[model samples]
Target: MKKFFYILLVFTVLSSCSEYQKVLKSEDIATKFKMGEELYNEGKFAKANRLFAQIVPNYRGKPQAEKLMYLYSNSFYEMGDYYVAGYQFERFASSYPNSEKQEEASFLSAKSYSMLSPAYTKDQKQTVEAIEKLQTFINVFPESKYVADANTLVQELDFKLENKAYSIAKQYNLISDYEASIKSFNNFIFDFPGSSLREKALFYRLDSAYKLAMNSVERKKEARLNQAKEFYESFKKAYVNSEFISQADDMAVELNGALENYSTKS
Candidate 1:
């Protein structure tokens, strides 16, 4: 009985494969469309994508084009081909403005771009583009069910940009390029005032200023020390209980000791 059941299942699988191959090679668009949709519904997106691609241009401007294009665009998305999926879904949304699936297509198109965003350490062109796409989707579909998700993606991408900027500034500090580090951190603070990293930025900026002052020549040391003192005060005012408060106090002790010499000279 077990052997019989196994043979029956094997036969069924072979028959299905045979039929799929026959339909794939056949020149009949209707048959291809039927099989493609069946495969799509059964979660066989790869096979469905092949059949849909063959018939897509032929069905253009036809009554079934809208449905066919939607299926085609989604098959790419299902297969993780985000670049093509993004473009195709954008095309589908533009082509069928009144489609019941139009909103879904637009949202998915934006989502596909988001999926293509690389890590924060890499070049951030795609990250910026994804944020723009998601922002546009939110503006266009203010009441969409997907708006919240789109906003979340935008926030995530925005943070990636913020992280990249912050890292570059921190890198400058690590290399002992205190002047460049101070400039970069200043730009970062101004650009992303609401960044989650703002606290770190403020601390690091003060650290850079303090280091630069401590290393300056005798002629420039007094003025740079005064500037560093101002940075220390600003950081303390913003975050009295910061994690770096101990280190900050240590730096302040050295700064005050140096400033006292200048004060005595007056």
Candidate 2:
């Protein structure tokens, strides 16, 4: 009985494949459309996409074009071809400005770009682009049900940019390029004032300043030490109980001691 059931299943699968091939090659546009939509509804997006691609141009000016375009664009989205999905959805929105699906299409288009964002450690051009797209969606659809999700994606992408900037600044410090590290951190503080990484930035900036001051030549030592002392004061004022407070305190002691030596020489 099980063997008969298995044979029947195999036969049904082969019959379906044969029919699908026939429909795919049949020059019947209506048949293609009907089969494409059925396949799409069944979550067979890849197969649906092939049929839609063949008939898309033929249905351009027809009343069914809008529905067909939506399905076609979403098929790419479902298949994770985000680049094409983004472009196609954008086109769909532009073409069907009055579509009931306009808001959804716009949101999905922006989301598709967001999906293309690379890791924070990589080049951030796509991340920037995604942020712009998401922001536009939020601004245009302030009352949309998708606004909350769009805002979340924007925040995530924003953090990616911030993290990338913070990492570059920290990398400069790691390479002992204290001047560049200080400059980068200063820029980061100015650019992302509300960043969660602000605390780390402040601590590292102080660390960089301390190292730079302590390593200066005799002629510049006193002035650099004074500047480093000021950085310590700034960091401590902001974070009295910071994780780096102990190291910061040790640096402050060295800075103050160095300054006292300068004062005694006067």
Candidate 3:
């Protein structure tokens, strides 16, 4: 009789639990959403997220689903898992193109990516992605509240990318890879005309060209000395007040002498 009573109690609890779940599901969908909001307000972000997730699939095609998805995205944002949260917010905005929350959703999505962006010298994929996504945000929502901040982020991230490239090009100069060095430095100048390092890049290119021309001799078919003179003259016109002017002039004199001597001997 004791074992029989125990079995009956277990069966009754199981049936009650199943019935409770069904009752919760049967409640007006708006009620479930309210419960979720209440949980979120009470700082039960996890529970609210689960509740919001629960309603979306069952309430699909209903007005509640659209609202629930927006709240669902905010739950993750509130939880501070920005990587996932950003993606979720973007998903909500993309999935519900006609919703009133569209602008808010896009802003939050871009903001979330900006939050996850790492420092410039570290992994920059997130930084790059943030720039691109935020540009899209700006293009889509010209009047968004996040525009000012996103604009700042785009500028900062672009500087970050440019700095990396500029540093690499300068490195070529450090190693005396003169041919490659001049090319890279010229690329930097052309690609980033407004770069703060523009003058420095131009100077390095002149230095590289001078050295390359110094390697020129009577035996080589290539008139590298002439090429070097061209680079020096180009740099001088761009940077007249440059500290390198006097030294560059000296190289030109030396290059002329070397070529003259080589020609006379040949």
The per-prediction CA RMSD against the true structure, in angstroms, equals 1.1, 0.9, 8.4
Task: Give the Cα error of residue 102 in candidate 2, in Å.
Answer: 0.5
Off by over 4 Å in 3: 1-59, 78-80, 115-128, 216-222, 242-266
Model 3: per-residue Cα lDDT over 10-57, one tens digit each: 999899567546535765666667777877888878777866776777
The digit string of per-residue lDDT tens for model 1 on 123-210 reads 9999999999999999999999999999999999999999999999999999999999999999999999899998899899999999
* lDDT scores in order: 0.96, 0.96, 0.80
Judged by lDDT relative to the true structure, which candidate is superior, 2 or 3?
2
Residues 1-266, candidate 2: write the lDDT tens digits: 99999999999999988988999999999999999999999999999999999999999999999999999999999999999999999999999999999999999999999999999999999999999999999999999999999999999999999999999999999999999999999999999999999999999999999999999999998988988898899999999999999999999999999899989999
For model 2, give the 10-residue run with minimal summed lDDT. Answer: 222-231
Q: Total clashes, candidate 2?
A: 0
Candidate 3: residue 244 Cα off by (Å): 5.6
- Error of model 3, residue 38, in angstroms: 4.7
Residue 10's lDDT in candidate 2? 100
